[model samples]
Target: MSTATAGFPLLTVTAALPAVGAVATAAVPAARRTAAKWLALLVSLGTLALAATVLLRFQPGGDRYQLTESHAWIADFGVRYELGVDGIGAALIGLTALLVPFVIGAAWHDADPAEGDAPTGRRWRPTQGFFALILAVEAMVVISFAATDVFLFYIFFEAMLIPMYFLIGGFGDRAHSAGEEEGAKQRSYAAVKFLLYNLAGGLIMLAAVVGLYVVTADQLGEGTFSLQAITEARASGELDMATGTERLLFLGFFFAFAVKAPLWPLHTWLPNAMGEATAPVAVLITAVVDKVGTFAMLRFCLGLFPGASGWATPVVIGLALVSILYGALLAVGQRDIKRLIAYASISHFGFIVLGIFAMTSQGQGGATLYMVFHGISTAALMLVAGFLISRRGSRLIADYGGVQKAAPVLAGTFLVGGLATLSLPGLAPFISEFLVLVGTFSRYPVAGIVATAGIILAALYVLLLYQRTMTGPLEKEEIKRLPDLRARELAVVAPLIAFLIFLGVFPKPLTDVVNPAVEHTLSDVRKTDPKPEHPVADKGWFDYTPGGDHE
Candidate 1:
């Protein structure tokens, strides 16, 4: 049986609830900003609960794309409002939900106005506008992941920029600036640069989406732009594009995802954005927002244009390797804690890109799981670094030394998070990274070996950062006086640490769900790239099991 059967619209409602909350938050008065925060929190928490419910109800080893809901919004134009998620999408949505509440809570006490004789003319307002902007982001990100329709996905994909633009330019930190004007100007430039790059990429994708529609309709007799319909037509050999058209469409989508992934040479905007945005905001930008790129590459580039994907794999793999080495080398040279995290993200994304292009079940599955693991690990490190920056009033690593003596809890937590970043054994990242390497090696042995070097470099950066910040003697008087984590702060961070341990020691359950979805995706891709001479005809690793689904 096909896994395309429609289920309840649970995922759709979950995606839409945040937008509803955004509207509600906007309705509140300016003087009652606290109420807006509470409302946004409640809304985000509700979305988390709904996501958990979906996780509980999700059936493993079944057909892909469960919890689907579709309604034809424009029959004449072949547009439909469709929503669904397989295990891969569900895993990412779960990560987004988990991060939203934490990001919101972390920003709770960040409001202060520097209208007085403060050293830094910084003003923090946890305003209704800010909370509403965050809610809008959560809404769009969830929708983007949940959207199965190409059109709806693109809409949510582009919609994300508005909130992020405002969050960085309007609500970000400007304390270290030469003056408020300069600070605000820097923030504005980062926001606009981000928007322009992403918008240009989106326009390219828009052309591709239209091209896809035209090709399908021309080939398949008044074709509908439905994902399932398109696939079915292709399966029946009723629809196929010219090689040139296919390659063009593939690039239209590829360029957009690469920019979002901020792969190698296109990664210029990330450092500036990370440096200027507030830490909590930076967490979402790096953790959830940037994932759109990699995920889209998997969903669009591979799913729709498998032949082109095969042709482009080597070029993309080379670029991924470059990002890995380049990002890590740059990270080691960073003085700012936040920019270091940003650079590390670029390196991690390179690893993810490698997994995607590996073109094996294990490689792809490992890549998907890496998305979840890295999101958690990166958020933890960034939040901890944010707290450290908050207390020290500086993000420069030189400003920190011997914090372990004064802030043991912070030191301990930072150590754990940092180790997790480097994929220490018995940690969540280790299992995922190992799977990626093993899988990549099965297909591309040389690239896999080089990728392993990236892992060694990861260890270097992570450990060096920890030793420099948390281990040395408390030389500065301020370092000796640095306060440990308060109970509330620990409350926010402890659960993330617990999850790391839980996911690390016992990853099978998550893997079980993940592997099957990956198997199904690989199976589909093989249908497009059939190998008749292979022992398993038109089958990838998904059909490798003896006397099972393949028969």
Candidate 2:
């Protein structure tokens, strides 16, 4: 029985609804910008409800990919419109839906017109277009997560950069250290750099995709870009590749994902992009858009080339270690709050990549959870910071002080965000970070020991960011008059903070969903959790067998 056999086109509707909403929102009259905003918000909420339905209907004990929909498209080329969700894909889909509404609310006025802003020039901030582009990006990302066909995944994977590019370049941050003209130039540079980097990666991936087709044609007497088809062929010993060919294919796929993941050397564009873009868009970049990359690593790089995946782990893990330490060290030195957060995200992504390559169930499972929790936590922190930056019209740490005195609620929320970033025990990120480190230690102890340094650096940066910005004497007049978060703003942030606390205490719901997928992925890579030298029971330390005495 095929996992992707005939079913209700639920997954297609889930993704397509937002894409349709984007078009509707974009068509609203310019004077009706407010209406456009409400429509986008409502669409995102609807998308969320649909995503929740997918989650509820998903059976963890069922087939690996469930609620799948497959249709014939480009049949001659063996390309089909196939969409499916395993636990990981479903969880990520939920994360995207969960965050988009908050992003919409926080960005309610982020794209509104400003003084000196040209009504008809490059400097114009089209309110409807901004919201529309966001919906558009969400639609692409949702489909990217749900896509099971290799070619189908790649199409949306590269297509998403279009809306994102416009979002970064067109609707830039109003608060710039430089003059408006200079900021505009900087925004252009960031947008171009972002596009060029990913485009270059996408082209390479395209070549690899072509190469994959050739391999299939020669070995199987047909060409197919179906993931299930290819994986089944490999498992049955009907398809084989030379070591060098498999390694090349793995590198090609991994490179594109790493760039999207924006690992280390390729990561230079993120800070500039995040700094120049509005806060919500920055969240969209790291929290939503970037997950596609790491998720692809799990889906394509490993799923298609398990042998080469093992061959490449050493180097991949090495790069991940560099990203962790390097991003943290740079973040500590950053003066701009948005850029600081950007660098911190790069560090967190490093940990995620490390866990994925750690090739253990705990590491992979933790990486999956990290994706979910980090999105919630970063959104909590970044959206609050955006609100603060908007009020003060500054992104500099030196420009803030005594914020706690006037806006105690705002300061408290900021504190929660900061603590969550540092992976404090009671926050959602701690569990994921702990599992990553444990998984790294189990397979790569020396790397794990070094990765601990990143945690210390995280604490330093988070606390210092808080100490400098949230506390101190009321020196600046703006800081003195800072207003507390309003009801609308509270609506944006409160739920995110609650999620951090709730998930921090109880991560079982997510773990239960994520672990099975991690096991499936481990099978693809032929890896297992390391057994403890001295076990109290038959199970290994990482085992999550339901807790009860067995007779």
Candidate 3:
């Protein structure tokens, strides 16, 4: 079970296929640029196929990581090349695989020349480099999710930033108001801001990793960075440390994840990055890349320092509430569509964090599933927004009017995505959002009640956006001639919409895959709900049980 049991090294191949495609795409001759695009698509589809295989092979109710591969690397330092996936990781990896091809397709014509530009004149083309960077990012993300060695995970985690930096800096759409020089400056500024924020967090976590290695060495007479080894040692009470030391180490890791999760006050960089990045890059960043932070929070922060996590719960829950309220308010007021989506993500992430800190199996399970649902729903919104921007030649909400008259399909798609964002009934996000609230309520009723207000705010923002952009009179000539969603666009969004409905109606399968992992994580953290101080009698004025009879 530890090694790739099948004939193929599935996880390694799945991760490496993208990199191989990147190299092949880059090696293609400049004259055959179209071939490079096809190559990237083929590679992405191939990776998706491999990911499906992993999913099919995955054991649904298993508590252990399956299809695992491990080998000794840096033996002197006790580092090993280890990769494995629990149910949670398997689902997210499947999400990553599913999204990349569509992202590639969405960007296919993104680099075309503007209207009235001379055909012979210099114009941007979707070059091999753009797709290569994307594939590179895919490889890194897959590796990060599959990695079981803390050091190995850190390596892939930091390595992920390089391609993403270029993707944001070089491939972003220039702001229309800003001249080329200013737009380039803005993109560069956002890219650097994103890089600096993540790098700071990564460095802090690196210190924690080194400290953990040293502590493990002191306790066991040999250092190790294997997640399984460290977790087992800590659980068995073989690796002990001072309370302060444990808290400090936990904070070191928490700081990085919180920044990446972009929880409230630390979330300033996200709006700028999302606003400046192209739609495909935005989808990747918001949908897949950002999940890394929360994933690491569940995988490392709680798993490695359960006591510290429990001790920090009150403060973490406070932060989560602030993020939920603050992000919603900002999103409601946003005029820029992209920045608005960015803020919405911050709000959704707040819910995810709240569930994680709720420290119950139900809450963690909901949080994990929320990560997947959010990716699907958000990707749809961003891509559709990109289409709208392309048509209107603007990103300002004020610039749109009567879009439904011009492109009914586009408007309808946006509405579907917006509805999903609001967690409307019969959509994928609703189930997870409901579970998070219920789980939180079961533990901290006051926080859960206050957080419920966010749902109302969500409906307001989504409907308001819809009303402003899609429901007005068709007065503008530019809007009158705009095209509806075309074949390619339909191809891109159809699966996402289908999934939103599919998961909404039938979430049991996904929850089944997620529950065991959630239970495992909760057990590792040793968290349980606090019992009520005063239990009410079943036949009395207040009955907490589901079916209490009143006299």
Instruction: Name the top lDDT candidate.
Output: 2
Could you give the candidate ranking by lDDT, starting with the highest? 2, 3, 1
Residue range 457-482, candidate 3, lDDT tens digits: 99989999999989989998888999
The CA lDDT of each predicted structure is 0.82, 0.92, 0.88
TM-score result, candidate 2 = 0.96
**Residue 312 Cα positional deviation in candidate 2, in Å, after optimal superposition:** 0.5
Which has the higher TM-score value, candidate number 2 or candidate number 3? 2
Rank all candidate structures by their TM-score, best first, as comma-separated numbers: 2, 3, 1
User: Where does candidate 2 stray beyond 4 Å?
Assistant: 1-6, 116-124, 533-551
Q: Sum up the clashes in candidate 2.
A: 0
**Model 3: clashing residue pairs?**
none
The alpha-carbon lDDT assigned to residue 376 of candidate 2 equals 95
lDDT of 1 at 130: 82
Per-candidate TM-scores read: 0.92, 0.96, 0.95
Across residues 118-148, which tens digit of lDDT does each residue of candidate 2 receive? 7545545689999999999999999999998
Displacement of residue 161 (Cα, Å) in model 2 is 0.3
Off by over 4 Å in 1: 1-8, 111-126, 175-179, 527-551
lDDT winner, 2 or 3: 2
Query: If both were scored by TM-score, which would come out higher, candidate 1 or candidate 3?
Result: 3
Error of 1 at 192 (Å): 1.4
